[model samples]
Target: MKLTLRLGKRLNRSWQVDAMLMLLLGVFGAFMAIPLIYVINNAFKPLDELFIFPPKLFVRNPTFENFGDLLQVMKGSWVPFSRYIFNTFFITAAGTAGHILLASAAAYPLAKHKFRGHKVLFTIIVLSLMFSPHVTAIPNYMIMSSIGWIDSYKALIIPAFAFPLGLYLMKQFMEQIPDALLEAAKIDGASEYRIFWQIVMPLVKPAWLTLLILMMQMLWGADGGSFIYSEQLKTMHFAMGQIIQGGIARAGAGAAVAVVVMIVPIVTFLLSQSSVIQTMASSGMKD
Candidate 1:
């Protein structure tokens, strides 16, 4: 009877701790949401009301005039806003697809196959992730310029395809799959490509989704500001910059554009496999 009581007390304590942790996490999530709330709230307010002293959390005169103005600009641009959106979409899609395909292919060999200098190759790939893009920016730009890829989609998309982080994440996820499964496939006369596509790929779907979310976020916002600023081939962020420079009338319009721009990715992320994000978060805590 005493032992039973002790066990019950321990279980109750664990529940209490979990409840407290959840409450803390809820508070942190609200704090993180504040900035997004602020941007959205201000996006609907009139320009005159925007700079009001003490600031209004709720707009007394919410209007869609800003959105209207932005739409007009988008419709009338010599280099249409649609073009910028298209460029961003294509580059992001191509880069992400390439990353997933190449990373998965590269990781399979590194994770499952035996060959000469495989360890060296894997080590180099892992080490490459430590090297920041900023450190290589000048060299990369020079190479792009030399190859005549500046202000082109190739410059943006091709360089991004070599994603070390994606490769590393895939390798880690692939390791979690049992080797016996692959060997069994081999016994059944399955090719390596078939084994990878049919068997391994499905098991790592969570990791793939996580990488997709991450890559989409990065590529969708791929301004790099200094690199891709040419007028002929400006990205969405660069177009927003141009709108901002057009002065106060366009300020509200710019904010409205930004709000819309921000929503697309956020909604896409939330809608596409949010469960994977939760799984990844839980996994991180375990590690």
Candidate 2:
């Protein structure tokens, strides 16, 4: 009877813990979602509704005027609106693609190979993550200027290829691969590069998806920082800033830009979320 009571108590405590976790998660989700919901609603709100005293969380009457205004605003641009779109798309695509390939390549060797100073190198990388990118921005700018890469795409894309966090995550994921599988490939006359491309790459589909999502988030809303100079080289984010600069009369258009700026990352995350979760589950540090 005593043992039965103890078991029952244990089960009760587990249930209590589970309930607490669920409640906390629900509250947190609601808090995070409220702003996103408001943003979506605001995008459809006409200018009058936007400025209504006491504001609103939802639109009673919806209209496409904001989006239309966005196009109209862009139509008067000195530079073609399409040029800004192309620049943003190109920068994001090039930066993300380069980061993934280079980060994955660097990760493979760090995870599987034993090389001199390897541990030290990885230690430095982890340490580097503790500092903010702002700390390195000046030096990075100096290096870019020294190389005559200022006002060019290479300045933006090349430095991103060595982002420490991506390399760290990719390395951790790669470590989950069995050494035996790699050895088997080697015995079968597979070169290191061939094994990496054919055998190893396919197995980490979820990690790649996770990496792609991270890279997308970093690149999608970029404004070309101090690296880009030419008017034609400016990104959609710069155009968004110009729209927002229109002030009160263009508030709805600004909201439309916000919606567009937010949608790409949100859609990308939704598409890759399942894979990211699976990858993260398998990537937990193991003893």
All-Cα superposition RMSD per candidate? 3.6, 3.4
Looking at model 2, residue 266 earns an lDDT score of 92
39 Cα displacement, candidate 1 (Å):
1.2
Give all candidates' CA lDDT scores.
0.81, 0.89
Candidate 2 lDDT by residue in tens digits, 1-287: 12234544653446667788899999999999999999999999999999998989999999999999999999999999999988888888898899989989999999999999999999999998998978998999999999999998888788878888999988888888889999999999999999999987888878888989888888877787688989888889988998999999999999888899988899999998999999978986543
Off by over 4 Å in 1: 1-18, 224-232, 273-275, 278-287
Q: Could you say which candidate leads in TM-score?
A: 2
lDDT of 1 at 240: 72
lDDT of 1 by residue, 1-287 (tens): 12234644653346667788899999999999888887887789899987789887777798998888888877877887877888778888999999899889888888787789988998998899899988989999999899988777888888877879999888877877788888999999999889999999997887888888888888887874656656657778777767768887787887787797787678867877765765476453311
Candidate 2, which segments miss by more than 4 Å at Cα? Answer: 1-24, 285-287
Any idea how many clashes model 2 has? 0
Clash number by candidate, in order = 0, 0
